[model samples]
Target chain A: MTDLQITVNGDPRRVPGPASLLDLLAHLGLDARSVVVELNREIVRRPRLGDISLAEGDTVELVHFVGGG
Target chain B: MLVDGPFASLRVTRDQPSFTMTRLGPLIFASMSTTLEPTELVDTPLTIGGRHFRSRLMAGTGKYRTNQEMVQAIEASGAEIVTVAVRRVDLDRTKEEGVLHHLSPERHFLLANTAGCYTADEAIRYARLAREAGFNEFVKLEVIGDRETLLPDTAGLLSAARALVKDGFSVLAYTNDDLVTALRLQEAGCAAVMPLASPIGSGLGLLNPYGIRAIKRRLEVPVIVDAGVGTASDACLTMEQGVDGILMNTALAEARDPVTMAWAMRHAVDAGRAAYLAGRMPRREIAVPSSPDRGMLA
Candidate 1:
């Protein structure tokens, strides 16, 4: 599989091609249940993560609640 | 974040120590008893944006020594509504970093926040992401204008509140101690307006009692004082201003004993709220004797 360039949380990273959002999360060792994903400004629901494929130069943002005041 | 909104409530366990503590809480703070006074009925189940919360004090899950400590402190604080910030998950350290790993959303109603955003658009984005995380619609909207003080940009805050409210969010705006801005937030359809007691993380305590009181007096929605509370008295004083509730972090997270301080805060908030409802005695210029003049001994 060819590697494609993508942005995850604003940092450029290369991942194997033909990857869905769920595959991308797995590549990063992230549990899909724990974090929420936003691809190109649209939130990809957990179940739809596997359905949406990562494109070249896709902007992905993975977020979760952290400790803050 | 809790899967269910109002359904997630604190769980009661039969564990020995916690059980004893829970039972003793009433005896320790009997004056600030959960059972309301006859005149002051219906203080519990603080309703906001159609959600109900038993606690008026809300604790943050930040700056804690450890996750275990944070959990203990939050538990001790007796806060049903807890605030969490939305941020990009650190990709490098993918070890159970979510606050959810420690705090149970089932026990505490999660109130997501946009703590670090500086612009209205940025705050709105964060709030949307938080909502998409599949919790409730509540967001503690903050658009900080000053990095030094972490004071909110009233303009940005108002814009974000309006946008989020329009998007069907229960916007809980965190602003400064300004009645005009607070009123604007209320008008913007915020479920609750949170005015800071002082600068964020400053521990300067309640800087303007009258200002907070003014907002509480004018706003029809709940006015919750957030930030800058250093001690139990600070929490008490802020609550005594007639605000609906208070949300604090450093006061508990930074205390020598965060758990004890959290416990103190729980009592303080309850006491302050009760006092506000009970009302205070009028201040007199001259000394007034409790004994009657006719009963005074010659």
Candidate 2:
């Protein structure tokens, strides 16, 4: 199986095809409960992470709350 | 019997005293049981985005020296809602020790803000990301127009507010003290309109009180004065202007003692709100004498 290239947090990386968002998160060693995932400029809700599969060239932005006023 | 009047109620009793007393207004009746006190006045709770907050003082969680200091200041401020910025999750760090660790959701409502976003698209994206992060739907929509002024991009803010409201997020749009823009945000279905007292982090206090008052008078929703608070007096003045709430950060965080300043802000908000509700006396150009002039020796 060929590796698919995807961008996460502006960094491009190669991951196996037919990977769910949950799989991608796990691959990055991220806890699913802590981060918010945006797939191609759209937020993929937490409950749908496992069901939604990532495609090649998918740009994902994972965001979380930080110290801010 | 409860006899209703325009501003107060007259209660008549058939007891031995047989007198009438008016409550909740300036009307004083001759009755032994009638005692007027400021504590008797009921304060209306500040409501925004369908949530009732006891503290009309919302605080920011930035610029603190440490997370412990942030927690201390937040506790001291007595703010029920705290604003936070949304950024890319640091994957290298453990989630347990993140900013949320210091804040208890049960005690405080985490208000996620699009602080660094410069456009509508960026703000909208941050709003969605915040929702997905389980911080609920409360979003402080800030679209900065430039780096120097740090003023909100009114056009982008309105567009972002409309989009977020349509997307089912409770938007609290940060805008300038411009009345038209504030009204436009309200019309865009924002839960609240947060007009800046001045530029962000400027510590200038409310530079345009008339503009803020005009916004408050015209809008039905909550008008929160966000940003540019220099001290507790600024917060007090803002609240006294009849704004629903005041959101501040540098005022507390940059103070010599952040915790103490937070406490001061908390009381200032309460004092201002009480003063506003109690109704201030009309301003006069000429001085009035308090002592009686009748039968006074020349």
Candidate 3:
């Protein structure tokens, strides 16, 4: 099986084809409970992280709270 | 680590006499908690989005020199509703922990802000991203118009507030001290309207007291003064205007001693609130004699 290139937080990463969003987070060593995942501009609720699979050329954003006023 | 910082000092022995101020801070705070004025008794908890918060002072989690300093200062400030900003996790870095690593969701109600967004759509997008963090739906919405001044674009702010409110997010707008704009935000269904004390980060301190007071007077929602406070006096004076709360960032984070400054702010907020509740005397052109004119000591 060929690897698929996906955009994660604007950086390109290659994962095995049709990897679940949960798999992407686990591959990146991210705690699913801590970060919010945005797939193709739609927010994926926590429980749905593993249900949806990433497609080629998809953009996924992982964001969390930072310091601000 | 139980031997350093104000939090660690919470374990100080009860017998430690002549305890240093910072070393034994919580004891002083606990002792000072007595009610000299029943301001809190009369004032209900600050309610926004159907949630009640005990502390009227909301603090930002940015600009501190170190994360340790940020944690210590925020903890020292006694802020129950703390504001944070949402940003993409830096994937290139070895490890970039989010602010949640320090702040507990159970302790501090996390209020995320759209701090850098300049347009309504951008602010709306940021707010949506923030809501997905699996926290409460409170957002401190800012639509900055000018890069140099960092003043808000009220037009964009109102539109974003309306959009976010429609989507079920509790909007707390960061705007200038303008009554008309604040009223519009309230009409837009914002849970709270945050008027500025001065320009953002100017530390100018309540440039227009009349304007800020007017906003608080007219708006049904909680009015929180969001920026431009430089010191404890600024916090106190801003609170004296009878606003529901005050949110500050640089005033504490940029202080020479953030921990001590946070302590001062907590006191200043309470003092000012109490003074406001007690009510100040009307200004007089001439002084009146405390002793009667007939009762001269001579």
Candidate 4:
């Protein structure tokens, strides 16, 4: 298993093994219903988010959006 | 008998430069003789998620001091598509006068944005909440990963865009001005791509026309010039570069006169698009005029 370290919300997070984007979201405890993800500054569609695997040393950002006044 | 009324002595000036002055009298209007007509403007009608719009000028329903102002501004801007970010009908925030009371769904399409989420999953969750709150199928997918810059996390953005598209949501992805990143989002099936001119509230104008143009040229989806607009001229410049549309908030919202600025942007967009389609004459090393050569006798 490849060791993965990615920046989530500007903090470096180290997780064991290469994980799919779904796993990362699960680890973050985010409901698939309330978030959007960007991988290396590119938008990834939700359907493929479950399938796309994270590589070692990947720069990932997770964005959560809620309605504001 | 002289009647005292608003139009008591409206006179026609030969060339009143200002809009209000020019409208003082009934004058013969010319179609695109000097300034371009909105009807004859360039950039083909854009179809996103089955909604076809002739004008690419998009308006947002925010930052207006009054709802009446928003309505007037929307009409003046000639924007067919107006975006409204959905919020919980904050009844508590306004026990006497509600915040959501300012907007009406009958006027325009409500574009629900996940404004505060920190990840793709979080955005999706908000999207569902928005839909459940009766916002319909359209979502303005904004996956902002940074609070300081408010930049869309491309990884999270792409992830959310794909998810939303698959789940039957018409996603209008708000992205940064990166061609490669935009292409990836387009490939992920976003209904439209909205790229920022600069940071969200900077109003710095179009920071990279070439990059936006490249994205407009390469992507099959509509390219909307979103954010960082300071004036009508800025919007026009973007339209001239072949953008499908312009989405602005702070520029008009913070202008000296929001209504007038909205109309100015509308006309500027129509004029610039017409100029682009009419094709600008190449900039020459020397002046070239359509007149007989002065030194022909030589």
Instruction: List the DockQ of the predictions in order.
Output: 0.80, 0.65, 0.77, 0.04
B139-254: candidate 1 lDDT, tens digit per residue: 99999999998999999999989999999999999999899999999999999999999999989999999999889989999999999999999998888888878999999999
Candidate 4 chain B: worst-modelled 10 consecutive residues by lDDT: B90-99
Question: What's the C-alpha lDDT at position B233 in model 3?
Answer: 97
Output DockQ, candidate 4.
Answer: 0.04
lDDT of 4 by residue, B148-201 (tens): 988889999999999999998988998999999999999999989999988887
Model 3, span B1-298: residue lDDT tens:
1335322212323333333433322123223445542111123467888987767889999999999999899888889889999898887773888999988889889999999999999898889989888788889999999999999999999999999999999999999988999999999999999999988888999899999999988999999999999999999999999898899999999999999999999889977875676568899999998877896678
Least well predicted 10-residue stretch by lDDT in candidate 3 chain B: B6-15
Whose DockQ is higher: candidate 1's or candidate 3's?
Answer: 1
| Superposed Cα deviation of residue A61, candidate 4 (Å) | 26
Worst lDDT run of 10 residues, candidate 3 chain A, spans A10-19
User: Which residues of candidate 3, in runs, are more than 4 Å off?
Assistant: B1-42
Name the candidate, 3 or 4, with the larger lDDT value.
3
In model 2, what lDDT does residue B146 have? 93
**Which residue pairs in model 1 clash with each other?**
none
Instruction: Residues A1-69, candidate 1: write the lDDT tens digits.
Output: 999899999899999988999999999999998899999998888989999999999999999999987
Better of 1 and 4 by TM-score: 1
**Per-model C-alpha lDDT, please?**
0.86, 0.83, 0.85, 0.71
Give me the TM-scores for chain A across all models, comma-separated. Answer: 0.97, 0.93, 0.93, 0.84
Ranking by TM-score: 1, 3, 2, 4
